[model samples]
Target: MAEENFETGDAGASQTFPQQCSSLRKNGYVCMKNRACKIVEMSTSKTGKHGHAKVHLVGIDLFSGKKHEDICPSTHNMLVPHVKRKDYLLVEIENDGSLSLMEDDGHLKTDLNCPNNELGKEIKDRYENGEVLTLTVMTAMDEEQVVGYKLDNK
Candidate 1:
């Protein structure tokens, strides 16, 4: 008979081999590649009969504010989660409903809710202080580029 070693501790159970992944899933242990991810949802599978189980995870990007989901691995190595990096900073807030964002390369300002541009109803709310907004991505420019524009016709 083959000797199997299953380690259990404060983190639950620890399996030293790959075949033991099914067991880890049954015990409610989900593997994570990015520990820094903000877990928005955690769901377990109800299909396990003896030693087959799985977990699902849904997470959001702290920087870009995007959502993503994936299946949990049974016995995989977990990597450290990358921290959300802020490439831009909120600078001066204009009198109008627009604001300026300063990054390492440039400045960006826009009135997303302004009328006559979108050809319809107003979409953007008036800019406010301490509001973290995701600026439009200008992939064509380099990181050192600085941008300056006006919200209203000036």
Candidate 2:
């Protein structure tokens, strides 16, 4: 199959392709209402006497933890966002408190915003201590955020 390219805020980077609702499973990543969410539960009801069977999907926003649901016929298609987790090295902290990340391949990303969570606080602490750290970046639909971090033993 031909590969599809997705805009990852970069000029021309290839990402994931769309998928059908039936193809998604629990914990799968999907794009709903322009937000990236993780499926928490999924169910299918039997076909009614005069209608098609329905698929019920419940998901939580990956970044906001907000619950969202959608009900559609089994044959309906859904946008499965191309979710990517990339590791970046913390190279600098900008004046505005944003982060400067360097990809494994040495590409610099300067506009990354740190999440407001416990993990985000820990990452900031490590950075202040002059310790090397690796950040896990989650990107979908051209939007990117730091989801996790770890000490860089290297």
Candidate 3:
């Protein structure tokens, strides 16, 4: 099989956009507590006298996996993050815990570091074992990190 060229598809993608709180739904990306998060639960409070309806949101940080909650007026706007994911072929791992990943077009990116967690340990272990790996990276709110990986038969 030919190598898949991962594309952004979202041409001219921006970091974030303003969206009304009432429109957000579960499993969607949002910016809460100044972090990019995935909306897990949402509830709406009835509007009281001389007040607007309120939306309560519970989300998990996309990068850190920490819970965050926020409440906003239904009609008020909140920052919604432009979440993006891409897959890259692993080329090599540097001694300093950096990843040498190859873009679909064959350009090597060496900026991202190996995650300091179980996944990072797994990546290191598999790389050391000489298994081909494909890594999925997530980018949002101007931040990027490795989120998952798969073994490659190539």
Candidate 4:
């Protein structure tokens, strides 16, 4: 018998949990090479003389947009990360680069930094032009980043 360790994704304290490699589905979250990623593709191989069937997975980082791949036995367990996304109205972009965001529930968050990417530049540009912006932020594995923005239909 093998000793297995698992963490429950409770209250955001823990960000990942263990699941059998074969049970994973495409587009689900997985930990690849120590980075939390979104599975983009998956494949399986037949059982071999060495052990159980093998599973191949390719994933992209939810935060940094990096690619990672891993192979594991179907019967073995792998860590799957829990990902969450939220949208907030842009209140202000501090000179220090932190974003002051307001939630729909009237909560204010000022800890997230404005990313130094194209999206970040766009956010600042639009805000300076007096446009209301809704930013999408994704959180996982104790990390958070701006992923995208929502377009106003009105």
Candidate 2 ranges with C-alpha deviation above 4 Å:
1-18
The best candidate by lDDT is: 3
Reference-based TM-score of each model: 0.31, 0.83, 0.88, 0.86
Task: Give candidate 1's TM-score.
Answer: 0.31
Overlapping backbone residue pairs in candidate 1 total 6
Best-to-worst lDDT order? 3, 4, 2, 1
* Model 3 spans > 4 angstroms off: 1-13
Local distance difference test scores for all models: 0.39, 0.83, 0.92, 0.90
Write model 2 residue lDDT over 1-154, tens digit each, in one string. Answer: 9987675555664444667777789989887776788999999999988677888999999778899998978777887877878999889876676998997778899888777788878887888899999889987877788888888787
Ranking by TM-score: 3, 4, 2, 1
Instruction: Report residue 43 deviation for candidate 1 (angstroms).
Output: 1.3
Cα lDDT for residue 37, candidate 4: 93
Clashing residue pairs, backbone N/CA/C < 3 A, model 3: none
Model 4 ranges with Cα > 4 A deviation: 1-13
Q: Tell me the deviation in Å of residue 150 in model 1.
A: 26
Candidate 4 residue pairs in clash (backbone atoms < 3 Å): none
